[model samples]
Target: MGRGGGRGGGGGRLAFVVAMVVMTEMTWGLGDVHTSVATVAQLVEAEHAVIFALKDYVRKEESRLETIKRYIWGWQDGRADYVHNPINSYHFLRRLTHDFDSVRRALHHEDLTQALRANITSLRGGVEAAAEADVNGAAYSLVRLQDTYNLTVDELVEGDIRGTKAVQELSADDCFRLGQQSFNNLEFDLSDKWYQKGLELMEAKQPITHEEQLRIKRIKQQQEHRILMRQLVTNMAKQSDGQMLDRFSGLGIPISFQRQIYAQHKDVAQVEQLDDYYRRLCRGEQLQPPEAFVGLKCSYVFGKGGYRWLMPLKVELRWDDPLILVYHDVLSEAETELVKRISTPRLATTMVHSFTTHQARRSLARVGKTAWVRRGDDRTTDRILQRVEDMTGLATDTSEDFHVLNYGIGGHYDAHVDFFDLDEKSLDKSPHQGDRLATVLFYLNDVEAGGSTVFPMLGVEVPARRGSALFWFNMKRSGKGDYRTLHAACPVLLGEKWIANLWIHEWGQELRWPCTRDPED
Candidate 1:
């Protein structure tokens, strides 16, 4: 079980060398595989893929190596950390050490194929033994094995040595340089290939240590996390409000908000009648906001600001009629419960930061968090738009547009105004017209402190509450602009919070809503 005895067979050593030379000749003869056809472009691509795979593998292997080494060293040094007496435990280590040695030998001889084959055999046995808990199974031997296998395959197929002299044959620096170039070009796939080849070379010379493996794993995890975030954002951009809300609900946060449905001038008469209409609208009855008047409100802040302050209220006048609604909460009890379930300390902070950074948006609208297209089929999002149309007594074909943003602690939208000013040429390529007219934001939960939607120039601080919404117009009725809509998410302090936003764009202006443009335009 120890490295005390060496294999005393010359036959084995001779066989290994012969196998290496034959394989090298075979690969080289595969039509300038190592030179003529080894264009920088093809080699670079292959090298990158190999590098990423090997980097991942090396990381895992290093972790297992650490565990095994620690145990062995501890036992040898008479440290209390080592546990003996279990024959199975010793057997596991024996196999693991053997595999390690095999890998070392293959690498030293520059024979990746043989090394990999031996490593895989050792790993399979090691994994099975570890799974059965017959040995010290705390080590993640399987992960290492899989990564190594993948890396070896990639390197074998893509690596090459070039130059007039053997001395200039593919150096480790050359492979790594190519890999770095691919990474710089955002060619992740290619970059990974080269890294793998470099790893193969390193492996042949010396195996990576445990600490190195840990560092590499963290790097890969970070990269993967970023990729996932980007994809999620892209998906969010394509969804309707209802769909977005439903997706948010699935993540365990619910939203509730109040919508203002203006009455038609002809439908208005006595003050009592107007009161009744308003009551009906609040009860979810069909009533539309007036076409002549615009509806506006303020939504919750994404992050917790440093200071607690009441939001400054403002009213915009159109023909002597005010069109904005201020102060409201956006979360339902069910939603609150869901938020409580999934709002972790780290997640809360991340959400809050994302919102404050303008990674999230807020708005007001009418709609259930979950819009169902068919029984058991959940897919509609324009419930707020439908409500607006119904209440206003307008007849435009309405569609749902919605979004759910998670604002954990420290969530803030840096400072941005939402308006799009794409030229005619750009408009032709856009999906939605530059028509974001108004925005509605609903605060799903309240933080213990901090969290406010701040308007710096106006010196206003709109606080967050359950079921409260803040609405505002980003675009004027004349299709012009309004500068007052510029806002930011203050930082969060304690407790977790949630919010849902709806950006109401003029028909065909959805594309513009998501883009940045001059508010004045």
Candidate 2:
């Protein structure tokens, strides 16, 4: 009901419920949808992107239909007046010359529906691929966004979040389905809230019953009788028009108004839970930086290589405990755009390593799509890897492929450590490729709103800025995994988020960053 009403009004009780449940289901998955604001500038270069293709088709088709409809309707309504206009006359000739052939071919088809079917068939493969499991996924995402942002059901139904507007308002039926989803997930409190809002909407929109209509008629007659008696008692002047007298009569009928509710904005200090830090940081609230980073200053890094000596990287020392730094202007705009183009075609659902089994599998904790691009995939990719080596002074030979990720609305990754915790017998372990020693994450684009790389334990939040890369050591100098380096990607509230990750391994960095005898080093 977010976009459509009941499928068939007369379909009995069971059918009505089914329609309610299915109507609000989103047509496409959020991860598959691209934001125009984020990608419109790259339209000429990314012509191969499916979103661009579809958008082009839609615009051309719509414009053609509008032109045809307007020209035909205007001619039919007033041919003389329409043709008298020089602009209209010119368009008439233009349409005959340009659009006539396409119109004739469509009409000549044995069945007019075939033209539509042919177009749909051409896009069916992509449509089916993008829509798989979309209903359940979309419902889950909406609920997650609701809980994370503390948004009220009324606010969401009205198509507003904090001050950002949704594309459209959700219908009463949409509310019912949302409540049903929450109930299925065993979120009773959230379910109750949605149900209450749905009921309120249904009651407000309910039409007057036959009995109520009859009661109103009776009341009107009694009031008329009373008016006549008063007229006789006072001997009032008789008005020729009784309709005018009816204007002064007051009939008490109740009208309903929708309830407005706003989400409570709590102070960052009041939020003490670990998960709360992620939400607060994403909301742009200031958090206390770690004490170790109090005296850290911005500086320049020439790495320990001849290549970087001429072009030192602008760096910001953000954290000191686990050694986190942000390298500014490390990537050019052209390079970032090329990475997005290469990764778009290969994007797939992101998978997480299971704690119990250590198997890579999909989970609700992370909602995004990712694709891996090795150094040889393209010259641009190779250049990016070389730049990573120069910036971090770490070898890229033992590192994994560049993992490019794109996050959609409400997309996020729960708190996680980057390094693998495998033993000798573990099947996931590679003999030569050591644990993930460090991570250099490049922000391909700037997020309009809430996408930030956050370290909840250290109360640190690094915002996504285009052309910037955040680097951090995942393991300690003593060759042990650092628990304090736990981090997560906060949910994207608005716009799009694109990132390329280069995970440097410990195998080739023995001398560059040597291990220490003291565990605390």
Clashes of each: 86, 1
- Worst lDDT window (10 residues) for model 2? 252-261
What does candidate 1's lDDT look like per residue over 1-521, in tens digits?
Answer: 01111132332333444455456567867655555554556656645655554564456456545654654453433322122211122333544554445445533423324665577678776333322222222111211111212323233223211111111133444455445544432334555666666656655665678865674566456556646654564455334454443433212110101011112224334423433433232222444435623433333432222321343223222221213344332234664444334332222211221222333322211111221121111212234344333222222232223345554322334344555533342352234334456666667676554456654433344666766666666665456655555565543322334665555556644443333455333
- Cα lDDT, model 1, residue 360: 33
Which tens-of-lDDT digit does each residue in 9-38 have in candidate 2? 222333444443344334433533255655
- What is the lDDT of every predicted structure here? 0.40, 0.66
Where is model 1 more than 4 Å wrong at Cα? 1-324, 327-331, 335-400, 422-431, 508-521
Q: Stretches of candidate 2 above 4 Å error?
A: 1-111, 123-125, 128-132, 208-272, 289-293, 305-307, 423-432
